[model samples]
Target: MSWIRFGRCLVAALLLLGAAGVGSAAVAPLTPDKKVERGGELTASREEFHLVVAKLLKDQGFLDKNNTFKKGTKMHRLFESYLQETLSDPAVMDFLYTSLKENAEHVTDFDAFGKALAGEYAVRGLTRLSESDFQELLRVMNVLADRLPVRDCAGMLRPGSAFDYHWLELLPLDDARVYLRLTKQALVAEITRSPRIAANTKEQTSVAYQALYAEIRRRLAPEKLERFGKIWGKPEAAGDEELCWGYRVLLSGILDLPVEPRRWMLREYANLLRPPQ
Candidate 1:
């Protein structure tokens, strides 16, 4: 339902239509075709699925923990100051304003921002899925939804998972829960384990945070920050890059993220994860 509403935006950032960083590759609009389940119908079973997960964990090493932080850690302080400064940056603010303005000129979906910068027109028929083949069409995405770890062109990064979770929801309730848990764990682990993932996530964390950063700045004053901090931040808030990245594959579908902020995010994430030497 949500996917239909949002138009099943695949890893929007990378799924750009062409190398020129243009529109989405045309995919046939998925229409619900009544898929007939035959008597012999079967998907991979639980044991088989676990074996696959095991291989994913083993081969990808996505479960290996590379960093850890509880609430009120230095990571909190780092995020707080870094975010305030970065959002306050003139160039960054200018980009947000212009991107939003230009986007207003073209399409109407203001809520989705990540790759909208690439251009709004999408062609659906270019995909392998034929018209009316909704069942096989979206399920083809299981391949992506299954890869819990966020590897980059260098490794992996996902700022959000709402999209993936939607796909997972198509599974039986019990199976969805188990698979989602497995994938999320792998997703988080990959971030902490791979410096590449960490860096990418950090970059993603910025723009994604910026969407709300303005409101946070405007509304969350001293007492507001204090009250919220006591509730969540405590002496400090939970400082997990993955929290922001929370498996975003970080959405916003704006243009490919700009350069400087990513560099800063990479450095900050490194500093946060590293011992203060």
Candidate 2:
């Protein structure tokens, strides 16, 4: 099956299981302060933002370590599935944009601003995600804070690049979407170029990898894909472990996953393709 198809099937299965209360705890939804403005510039402190996000996640049963959903849930899987789906979904993205834009006034810390926006949306009926999905949402928020221009809680063309302060008043959802698409495309290309992704000696593995790579490449701009291919062909990216590590580094950079977890995931994936001793 195509990766997209596989992903849809997987999400459907997970949602079905979650709906059935399969290994899920009967957790109550959080009740945020009704006084908090639902449609205004986010002025919450960073600590307040973190507290809200944590509370919402906990309320959704995301912090339940004993849940069956944690098993086999890698950061990359979460990114590829939940984060990708959320970012690509027009309805979800539109909701996110509207929430952020409504709360975009008086925001000084972009990190806190974005989380508060997400938390606000979660409390307002965006909490239908699985535990893994919640985790991905949090991770994606972190990545956006780190990579996107957010000087003084304002989106920018680049660091130190000045623009009309009035323009910063509006939420840059269009730019945010473009950024997400580019990042996802780069991640897909990087994963496709990983040597550890397929067994070199297995024809079936080779064919599958090629087909998957072609599909991902087909979605990317020709010039962008060409640039990525050149980078992948470099000597430093040429070996099983090297390419694996390269892919891990790329993912870590984009997804904001900690080094130790990303390293462990790469090792686990490599072992799956490794020959028996």
Candidate 3:
């Protein structure tokens, strides 16, 4: 699962279901379908790559202009599943940890690494890492490298407290957003569709959600003290007892659950989530 090709596969599988391992989902290279020849090199342009992503989002009705499924849209389970499965799969974690470890050990100069990578292909393509993104990636990897793998998915928070999804193994800064979107959008859709659901619950869910996002922004960054504005476009207001949990039901207070905690995030999110196997 070279970082070189991760996003390419993620987009190609934009519509694929069942499997979502970057390790197995590897694609031809960095970006999308538009092939261009530049100085005898073949690679997709960022413009073309973004175009592909835009179309995929449109066709699938997955994300809104805000880059979230805030319109009550849920893409296929595959996008969210990528994070879910990757975070839960021991094999995937092993591959990721090893890659990040090597990158950290060998690539002291991220800019130099990017420069070297750029020349490897006759041309470069989509999801190709720019020096900035690569630097950010390394920074993220640094944080990840220091933490115990699986991100303590089983212990993200105290038994009585809450956890942030951003700390989850799915690279919360990136794809975990999709997981949140899918999980929430699905919950919203279900509430509307289910006669078994309560209406005030949606209002409560909304309050919790806003509070959750605020807290998510607060806890996830170096500038945790910001009172307003956004971090990565997520609100940094603050949270309350209506704890906003993530990753899955296990951290959703499973042990505290009166029913079998097998999986029951807002009623098991039965349609959207499953306990990590």
Candidate 4:
């Protein structure tokens, strides 16, 4: 017979909402009593949980349509060049590198990134559940899982529902698909409705893309400049500040759309600059 155990501990929640900014907050860890016997539970450390959550929230549904590329449109060309340049930025690369390093340093099964960054060192306990308790946990988790937003945070610029999907998925379950959809929808609604969301989206997009472009130029070959285009040129001359800002806002709103939309936009833009066969 399978057994069930029910225990309540504080769940840590330390979510970063945007790019290249540092937030200092200590999260309390949930130390489970002991591992329950009879079933397998994948233990994840803090960094693992943080990374998982970050990936979940990185979907495209979070933005508005204006930020995304329209097929066969001039906007698509601008987007492609802008994106390549942005990705090439040094600061952005540093941010990505830092995030990755932090993730790697703290990915222990015993603790989450929340604990690791906080500099807490200790192997906490994990309570084992009876089969029945496990089922109940699953039930609760399922209900919460089903609540995940399916849309992208494109417009919201905050780590919303899709963001939660990461931590939630860590729990053993069968309702991942259902939860993921809901999370996207929830995020879309939340981001689209807020008046301030647009501003936030613009700010984040500027920071992320600008950093990316800066890094690209710093690291890549000058011969490759043609590929990125004169995007490296002054933004004022190319009307980039205005165009790019609008693009980011749009991308945040529709990040959940088929990656193809953005992908096609980028490809088309690239081909236009240097005719492709």
Candidate 5:
């Protein structure tokens, strides 16, 4: 059977037992209604995506433990299933197949396949790229960016380690700190306006943000400090553009906040990050 079907079956089984209560012997699954009302279900789940994937790779012994490592198990199976389904998708397979067919004579290595795909997107315009394409693009980015593992860079030494959750290496500590300080305040205001989130949950988020920020501050470097300043202070400066984008994407993923507002915030911050050239 298909991976998607399998995943749904798993969820269905959990939901069934959850509904039956099983004489208090079974733990109930969080209901969809509750998840919608609380907001944490989706936010937390989405935030865990990378962390889960990281753990999966480590647990499966996919990486060289000495050089590249991860700590967590939650992301492993979920991400594996996601990749399986992604590859199984006919459109993605077709894209890969067609690209391979077109470049068969000249291109060979796995890297060449990736570059061809990226080139195809570039020619088509980013607007034309589908969600699958975007997902694939991010996979390529992870390979290219080689972002320091949360364990190594963030000072998370153990499994399930995360800033606001645990302590490890602290490489990005300072960056997380300053950004969270600004973002938590903005989110509180937004939530207050919408009332979609409970006041307690917002407070919890504040605590999470505060803890994360403190952790990040400890890891700041001189160049990163400068970059942070330029991005946060002078949004109009060209130097801040790239920095702002990095901050917006990374922190949004880390914090489980909407990227649209964060992107706007980054744009605004960019103006203050540096003087006009």
Candidate 6:
């Protein structure tokens, strides 16, 4: 059966077991055993359990748009149903309780317990994840990426293309030029630092760095190249405060480039640039 279908059936079976009071004599509370005294109030774990149940119901769309877990709300009814039909099942409750209690000590609250359960479920679910599950995950990730304020520029910048100058238009022209230069330098540095290239003789290494940097520089605007030379021509530019910060941000983005084609492309470029024996 599909995982979601199996999950629903398991939940239904547990509900039937709960209704029949199976293992009722050995039933256990889903919360930690200890209680804290404060203003004669409910323990934090109890409060957290209510909040967690409410959140789960809301996330699952079991709650009405305007409904909350107030005393008389539909959300509250759903939560009650969950408690009676699922949490009350001795097998379900005991499994969750034992899983959390055994793996985590700070799970004294229901929120912590819920998070712990989620982590455990995720790990176990991986064993059953199918190709469709992976595709769905990718779909969801794409949707989320599209909604993010910052655009995902993954794979947009090719090795021989001028870095997209439009992305840096918000900065001063000089700053933009510096950013582009630093970004290229960072890329070259990364290419040379690769163990495949770095293990070579010093002359071979220098040739590789120069060949890669030359290819990249050939693609950039002449003005940008001029600005780069004007600033970085001096040895002190390597330690320049502003350039260093820009280099870090640009290098971080390069380092985080998607591993698939980009990594393979870099390896290819390194091989092609290496001096022949």
Q: How accurate is candidate 2 locally (lDDT)?
A: 0.34
Candidate 6 structure quality by residue, lDDT tens digits, 151-255: 222212111211222333344444333333322222222223322322345454344334434433554477754543443333133333323332223223223
Q: Higher lDDT: candidate 2 or 3?
A: 2
**Candidate 3 residue lDDT tens string, 1-277:** 4322432232122112111111011211111233422222324343454455445434433322212122333432434443343233333233323333345445444334332332221011111322232223223323432342442422322232222333434454454434333333322222233232222344443443333343344454544323222211221221311112222211222222333221121321221212122
Question: In terms of lDDT, which candidate is stronger, 3 or 6?
Answer: 6
lDDT of 6 at 99: 49
Tens-digit lDDT string for candidate 1 (1-277): 2322222232222233111211121111110112112222223443443344334333312222211223354343332332233333334334334444444445344324523321122112112112212122222333333333332211222222113222332344444433333322222223233222223354455553353333333555767544433322221132333222322222221112244443333233222323222
In angstroms, give how far residue 13 of model 2 lies from its true place: 32
| Cα displacement (Å) at residue 165, model 2 | 36
How high is the CA lDDT of each candidate model? 0.29, 0.34, 0.29, 0.29, 0.31, 0.33
In lDDT terms, which candidate is top? 2
lDDT (Cα, tens digit) per residue for candidate 5, span 137-220: 223322222344422322221223222211112224343232222222222222223221112243443443344333334445
Q: TM-score per candidate, in order?
A: 0.19, 0.21, 0.18, 0.18, 0.27, 0.25
Report RMSD for candidate 3.
20.9
Q: In model 4, which regions exceed 4 Å deviation?
A: 1-71, 105-277
Q: Per-residue lDDT tens digits of candidate 2, residues 1-277?
A: 5544442342232222222111111111222333245444545543454466445444424434312234454322332333434333334444444444465555444445554444333322212322233334324333433443344222221123222212211324443333333333322322233233222344433343344344445555777555444434452334433333323233333233334333333232233323232
TM-score of 3: 0.18
Q: List the residue pairs that clash in candidate 2.
A: 40-103, 41-103, 41-105
| Clashing residue pair totals per candidate (backbone < 3 A) | 29, 3, 5, 62, 29, 0
TM-score of 1: 0.19
Candidate 4, residues 130-173, lDDT tens digits: the string is: 22222232243334323333222221213331222233333334
